[model samples]
Target: MVGTAARVTVAACIAFYLCRYGLDAAVMALYATFTVVALGVLARIPGSGRQRAVTTLWVLPAGTALVVLGTLLAVRTWAAVLGMLVIGFLVAYAGSAGPRIAGAAPGMQLLYILPCFPPYAPGTLDQRVYGFVLGAVLLAAAQVLILPEPVTPPFRALLADAAEAAAALADHHDGPAPERTLARARTAADRLRPSRVPPADLPASPTRAHKAMAHAAETVRTLLAQLAALHGAAAPRGGYHAETVGLLDGIAAALRQAARALRAGRRPGAEPSVAALQAGLDPVRTRRAVAALERLGVDDRLVFLRRRALVVQAADSAVVLVLATRLLLGDRGVGADRAGHAFAYARTPAWVLWWRRLSTHFTPRSVIFQNACRFALGLAAARAVAGVLDLSHGFWVLLATLTLTRTTSLETRWVVRQALIGTLIGAAAAGVLLALVEERTTVYALVLPVVMLAAFTLGPLRGPAWAQGGFTLVVATLFAQVAPVTWQLAPTRFADVLTGSVIGLACGLLAWPRGAGSELRRSMAGVCTAVADAVGRTASRVVEPSAGPADGAGIVALNRALVLAEESLAQYQSEPREETARQPDWPAVLAAGAHARRGERLLPGRPGRIGDGPVGGWLRREAGRTAEGYRALAERLRTGGPDGPRGAPTDPDAPQLLNIHGLLEVVPPPPPDTDTDRAAAAALLVDAVVWLDTLTADLRRIHGEMAEMARRAEPPGPRLA
Candidate 1:
């Protein structure tokens, strides 16, 4: 990281010289880059589509660097803020759109890429805007040509892990060692880092690459799903061919790309590549997904042995409500989003909430309202300074302080607290460094490398709050170099930052109005939906003991829902609102989610040890066979060609996993819990329709609450009127 930072310093300087600004400009720009990269890395915490967007939003780093650099160098503020907003919007646009459009795995890129640049740049507001536009373009180009490559790296490691997982299932079923095989596979997968060593040596054709990646995904998914099924036994008979599934599905997506490429008459290598890897299998991350038809446990399935075909047909009723009511509403930003907002609001705190709310309310004059209500106040203040004011940098700095400075997680809050401390320390260090060099050439050289070190150390190191503070200080001191802050201007420059920060807070509050209650309601709804979806998926799909995929898919979805729920709980805790919360049995909602998680194997809970006798052996054999079937399927998928991957001609020894309906069902009373273990196992049983029913109830309840509020606010419903 230090070496990288050193490289960053040099590059920043070159950009500075080429871009022509102050030394402080260079340092601040680098700071933004470091922040963006760090945040992108951190956004991996877990939450909503917007949380993913926030994580992926890259403009913060790039734009911030530009604005700060410009501010110290005498660039106008307006340009800085404008650049920040435009790029911020673009960043948001890209981050949000990417996941909805790109294949699931690649969405991880948002975490890796968004934070590599400044969210706001420094300078004359116009120049800052220009800087931002340039930086955004650079980032876009980098992502198009470079970003996808990194996203694919994690999966390659994942691919290898899947292979090992398959091998583990194989050996376990074959009565050899299971733990050792699984351990090795786990370790191998852990090492795949998209940050440094991405996946290697592939064909030039993106379609081919996509195909390889897709195949890799299928192999991993199927194998992991199967491995999860196998308890521990060595089965002799063959099972579903897994390698074939992974390979074929992977190739299918690649072939789709290939077809497009071939029709376009482009050379394989020369084809205009949208992705570094060909897009692969449709991610069956949904609750009760069809993809898990192979990975359900028979016993687990039997528990939910009644219901089949869980369909979630949500017809966007909110649209009708939106059109009908004069006051339109949609649950676009759920409560999870509200907490996610807190993470972004670290720079300015609850102002994050305000901005989100204000943006929605001022839709008719959204842009104009934002500019006038948010900026005009700040602009008026800027004009007070001089007609030659720099509003752009000020604007974005304010914006980031509003949107990006979040405290959603303890870690996130800690990150900011550390950064602030770092900034203070940095101010002092910079003062010391400034005193020593007296604004000389040697000072410039010395500070440049120091800034680089800060960037690098801040990348991966974690501990006490001091880490961020110290890191921030190091960069701040070096970037707040004295070359620009001559004897006469030093105090004023320092004061400007404080002023900018204050203005930023003020703008954030006024511009984008937000309320906690709405977020809470929305988030609760989402969590319920996610919970129901996960439970439903598990019950419906994970019926076959041998193929048990629904469990894993359910695990992933349930975990996501859990995260949103946890976040909601935290946000609800963070700001206590009397009216918006409680009454709705949060504990029950949480308990339901908890139940979903345990049943899905996403959380830690013992499934009870069999009496260590005949039952144990029988269970072991069953699990082993399950493992074998999963392995067989995985192997078949990885190695199989065009003929539908599995179910091919000439395989006799394979243990068939076809009869699934008998294995699982949704019964009225989940198998009688004779003992504690039985009860816990029963608790793990999925209830697809049950969760959905609960969700519908909750949604209706929330709607009623909203309706009540409306009734109270207006004259009344028909009853009162």
Candidate 2:
């Protein structure tokens, strides 16, 4: 903050002196000074100095265009208000693209608001453009050349660390300290959590590479859980078969290679290790191994199936890791394969990617859309009010509205109260200063830089009140130099702020007043339903591989629903909620969605299909039960019910018809010569079992979390009355 304050002060002083004293252009001077404030204090572009400089350079053209539009619209009251509405929505909605655009949005809005005010300044448009360009160039230069911020760790490095941890955990799944390795792997996975990572470093953008990376991170966590579960299951009489052990070792090696490639900033070469692992675990080889185990008198069918399920699941996760890593390293060719469907956007046009991102948030259910609408409406109303009242310094009204409004009414009200208090105090101080130093432009000029430095430094550290008060003093001093000012200016500033605050408060109440709290529940419910549908569809496809292609619509819905849920969660965290607010386990909800989506992505690609025999029928029944369980949970969430469904079924017979031991007795093993049909069926069954097991475990965990939250939310029994 100190560094930023110094940069802003130096740049603004230079721009002000050049325009005001040297060129004697008051319009240019005012625009230039405010431009520094807008980009420096209002916007918070994050990245290395070079990145920020580039962003600033890109914003200049947009800012110039807005200035021209605002100047043209300033000729009429209605036109200005309309322009505000359109410009506000566009600026705010553009945030869906990424963090850089989002960060620069508020400052860009200011560029327009500054010009769309009284005096119908079309003739001064050139001055405004010059001032904006000069301020932007100077600020960009300062960002790069003066007190630049040190670069933080990149997201890829974090992923690489996680991959290494996963490899270690895989190698030690049955080692002496399996629990310790699992814990360490889990810790590494947690580092990639959305809440832990910086927004700029997150892979949440709309690009295909980012999406693939995000999914890969989620899959890594899933891989760890599978390894732990596999270790917990009873081992075979002679440990895992040689083939199974070899497959596990291959998975570990592939993970290590991926880690190395990511660290070295190179594409993992051709994914031969993954392909080899896949080939080694082919249906024929795996089925022969199972038959060989049966021949060796290893008759614990339950243990046999459970262990195989875990191996197949782990192998699936490894494949996704390789594919995602390749894509992240700019291997666009990976998307050509069926398994790489998740990276569909790898070769998409940039504009289409951005458009998809924006269009996805166009629904009212989206927090981004809600915020954009609320922002646009509030600014438009403020402009209209200012114009009708013919208030002096009317742009201040819009500025106040921009700064004070928040997603939730409660937060907005709190901010407005703080800002009003700060504005009142600062206005009184400004009035006294004006009375004491009348016509002393030199005194105002000397103090402006010091005030700016202090305000920019402390305002963010101290909260909204200090920021508002400091800004009030800043504008007071700045205008005093630009033109003569009296004590009356302070009262006018207060009035304009008050009016804007009222406008902001109204908009907040009228538009999504609860912020994401309500939307979160709705989105979570939608995600749960989508997950349930995807699970059912995926299970069907596994049981019946020819079951038409994958349910693309269902997959897309699940993705969209998860995106909305995540956005809502982000917004909810930022809003002010009541202490007594009862919320579900949000992280668990997100995990459930991710797990379901991962299954949908990987399960259908498994070789072979289960015929409509007893095992296939049993698998379909279990999948139906799992889907029903999720739907029931979704209903509870939608209706705001406290208690969730009971924990997942733990009975041995619950997962299969007549239990695995009984099925083994009834179903004969394949002959020494591998039958392609039997081999395929065996492989599909193993994949299905693992998918269902993992899905149920995740559901059980989420249910337990929800039930715990409900128990806490429940009112105590009359306090021993």
Candidate 3:
């Protein structure tokens, strides 16, 4: 619907333009009108209002301050200086935030507004000269009145995340049991998504929700992992593992089904399999869970079901707020149809998603600091060019300025190279577009969507850089030819854009940066260290599930490790050096990681790290038979396989375990204090010492690079709220 609406709207708009104005004129008007509409939409977003107000308040003064400072510093006044400041502010802001932040969304919207501003505009009256400002305010008010409460994708996403988290937690405590843990986990995840209308649209309690949700998630993960082990072991179908996996297959079903059931205002005749699935991990969680079930006034099953329903409601509401914000702000006004198609494609692209997920490991703050210095250099370039150049049609340069993609010098230099190629092609294409501009303004209208499509097709699928060159041409051509002859304007515009990109790009390359390899290597060490810690900790008496810092897999902690491993592999693969330094191949890493995770998950009880004291020792014993699990993981990470069996360690007695606890602490007296006793103690101590030393050595070797990166990089930019 979004895609169709966008395309049709453009077609209708253009058709209207053609009749109301000459072809050349209508196309310009269309671009102008769309640009205004898009900016109006962006101004409605939450933080953007603050950012805009701040920027509006700051830029003029900042510009003045800089001008004075530079003059005092003996710097020359330059026309391009203002443009450089604009780009700098943008990079700083966008780079500071996560996807949820208002940074990039607003930055992208700048493209729409730029073409309407003085430097780029063709002496046409600023649209705001009319009642456009008042009209926009009125439109905003109407939309707020009409738009339904936000609940949509963000809410669904939140619900899903909460559910997944709960499932993870259940795994850690109760673990999977046919009747209890899975169903309980599902209920926990589902509770946030409600069907009933909320009261007063009250401010949400996000932090509280996050904590509860995190706990539940940990439980669900622990159980599901155990469940997966059972399946891989080819254990029987009706066992806890089978049913647990069934629950995982459609986590949302419990809430989705329950919502319908609730809205129907009648008890469901037979709940979907999800209710059963939600309880899959309960048997091991300590009898407290089961006891809690009995204590509730509702039937045991219904109690769990109702709990999940609440989760669903909360999750749904959060998502609504997020998506509502996006709809209002993510406008660059290329064309509503084109923008819609781009967003649809961008949001759902399978490959892009894989990449985005990979990028999530390195926080946005890190990315900004990583790129800022280089981008600043690019800004300098655009500034110099803007001041010096005089091309008849120069916006292409500005467009070209925005075209380049940046990554570690190793990752995909091709992205940068391709952008350059696209720009060259687009420049050639722009000549044709310009010629047509004289005869038909509709030609520029044709140019706008085609440029967007071309940029989409030729470059990275999303982001500002992709279609910049083409769109630059659209703006440059329409204004230059249609508004009357202008030779100097184009050159200045092109140079201004070019210099900004150059400055930005160079700063990113330098600025005390660290390579991702170093980061990944450190994560590798940390992953090993964590495993060792988990193993060693378990050596002590088993911490009761109900008592202590909780039991089972510190599954969330482990997930973080896995996420790091996954992230490392991506960085490794994405950033292969020009020659030396063996890049860790991601697919290989993923395969190895799978086996390693299986080994950890398989341990009946929570495992501890190697040499993690007595508790770790117990954890090691439970993690897998022998020290083989750790040894196997270490080997596979370096050179080998996902070649291990599941369920091989079931019901093992003492020595059959690797006995990390035994290594860490004195076992019951070995015998009388004769030669035998002395020899035994000495030998054990020596062995323990050797193992500890080796483990630490291995850890440092694996993660040395990552540590170095943290030391070198700038303080991470302010995190987007």
Candidate 4:
């Protein structure tokens, strides 16, 4: 907080000094400096020197161009208003693309809005542009030299630790926690510096290593899930047979080599082959273990338990084998290096992505586009109202409108309430200070920094209202030197802010009002849909081992959707509630997704022989049924209705898991002389049946919750008066 206060104070002093010397376009320097500092603080984008430099370079020219254009348009009120609409739409659309773009949007929008406050000539425009460039340079220097963030060591350590975790999970050792390991990896990746390493060729280059490691982490998590299933109550206390253990050992060794390659920032000269890992676990030896169990007259349940563990181990080994290969080789195949393609491969083309994003605003259903339109219209309306009232420094109203307005009605209301309260308190304090403070320099030098520091520290803690007050105090104090600091104008300024706040709120409510509650439901439904799709895909892969590993891309998508859902739900809970019902069963949705994901991982382990008889048909049928149920649950959640597919929904009350005991009756008790293949088949059938039962139960619970929420839905509240 203190550092931020010092930086702001120093920048303001420099700007004021430049302006005092009658430098041409010096005011532009002051505006640019203040704008850079304010927006940088809001975005939290200056985490690294390179990033700060890049931002400064890009924004300096961008801000200058926008300001110059807005100044030109400001010659006529109608023209300026029209220009504001175009600029607002573009800025908001850019922001909606992603977080990186979102951070820069506010600074760009501010540049466009501020220039319209005062008309400027061509000569003045030239001066302002020059001032903006100088200010940007100074800001970059302050960020890099004054407080240079340390880089390299932390990032390297995080990468190394994540790799170690992946390797350790493959080892199946009790030393490291897989969840904690992956969590650390995620945290590190999130905070990684934007700078890329040199010689970024080949598929899994250092530049793309994080993505590889992340994928590997997810694969390891799946492996752990498999391990959990095998280690459950049905499995024996004794460890896996010699052949299965050997395969795990080979996978462990392969992963260790992959970790080393990641640390060295290169793929290994000779990639570890999954074939070699599979070869270590001889099929004859694994079959012999099953034969031995049958010969010993072991109970069918015991025999089934032993074989289930082996199948799980085999499936887990296969998954780790592929993931370790991916970690070392990257997303592109081994031949990618010879192809001489250096750039990362994206699923969609750049032009197509942009076209889809921009085209959405053309439709009536595009909330973001509508919100942007509303914000622009509201700002224009505020400007008009300020002129009608003949309010002094009416740009203050427009500033408030720009800052306080948001996409949803609830948020806009909250911000307006806070801004009005803060402005009133701040304006009153300014009036009192003006009466006592004779020397303007004292307030500028001393009081300014104090208020700025308070604003920086208390604003976030107390919410938007307190922050607004701090801003008001800073503005009032700074302008006291130029304009008369009278009680009359302070009230007028407060009134301007209130007027802008009202206009912003009206626009939010009137123009395509979508509450946070609806957004949460939508996000939640999307996540549920992704989970259902993943479940179906996993089932398909299980039915055909040749179909390859459960698509890592699907799990990754589910994760991103889950994150969006959680964020939207949090925002929904924060808003004032009209409906008294509890928040939608989000945790239930998450639980169902988790169960579905784990069940999907278990599918890859079905023994090859299990595909032959009635057992095979039963296993496939159960998996298909579970997949269908998930699909129906997804639809129900999405539509907020009980219109799920017509089928026998799993009865949560009467649970029936196809255990080893029941399976023995169906499989003819795999005779004492049964071949190794039959013994393994019986065990795998039991495993599949048990997992299906578990997943079906989870889906049923989710379905029940979805039905309840749908039933409780009230008719839309009375339309806005």
What is the lDDT for 142 in model 3? 31
Q: What is the Cα-based lDDT of residue 97 in candidate 4?
A: 49
What is the TM-score of each predicted model, taking all chains together?
A: 0.39, 0.90, 0.45, 0.71
The numbered model that scores best in lDDT is 2
Which window of 10 residues has the lowest lDDT sum in candidate 2? 649-658
Pairs that collide, model 2: none
What are the clash counts of all predictions, listed in order?
136, 0, 127, 0
> In model 2, what is the error at residue 171, expressed in angstroms?
4.3
Best-to-worst order by lDDT is: 2, 4, 3, 1
**Candidate 2 residue-wise lDDT, 321-408, digit = tens:** 8778888887887666657655556667768766767788999999999999999999999999999989889999999999999999
CA-lDDT, candidates in order: 0.35, 0.79, 0.36, 0.56
Lowest summed lDDT over 10 consecutive residues: which window, candidate 4?
197-206
How big is the RMSD of model 3? Answer: 16.8
TM-score of 2: 0.90
Give the alpha carbon lDDT tens digit for every residue of 67-104 in model 3.
Answer: 23322322232534454445544543443332223223
Superposed model 2: Cα runs more than 4 Å off: 171-174, 177-184, 225-241, 266-273, 283-307, 347-352, 641-673, 709-721
lDDT over C-alpha atoms for residue 689 of model 3 = 30
Off by over 4 Å in 3: 1-97, 100-219, 230-368, 384-399, 410-417, 432-469, 480-482, 486-515, 526-657, 660-721
lDDT of 4 by residue, 1-721 (tens): 4454555556555664565344534456456555655454554443355565566676666677887887798676676677787887777656544344555675567667766654445557765666556656666666666555444343334444444544544454332235655454445333332223211111121123433443344454444444443433242336555655566567666655555655665554665445556455435334544454344334532445444444445344444434444543544453232111111222324464355445533433344455567767887787677655656677778778877887678778878998898989988887777667844655554676677667766776787888788777777666664445665657877888888888889987888555455555556666667776765665555545655553355655665565456545544555564444544467777656665655554445445444435554455555656666656655545565212222222345222333434334445544343466655554444445445655666666666654454445535678987
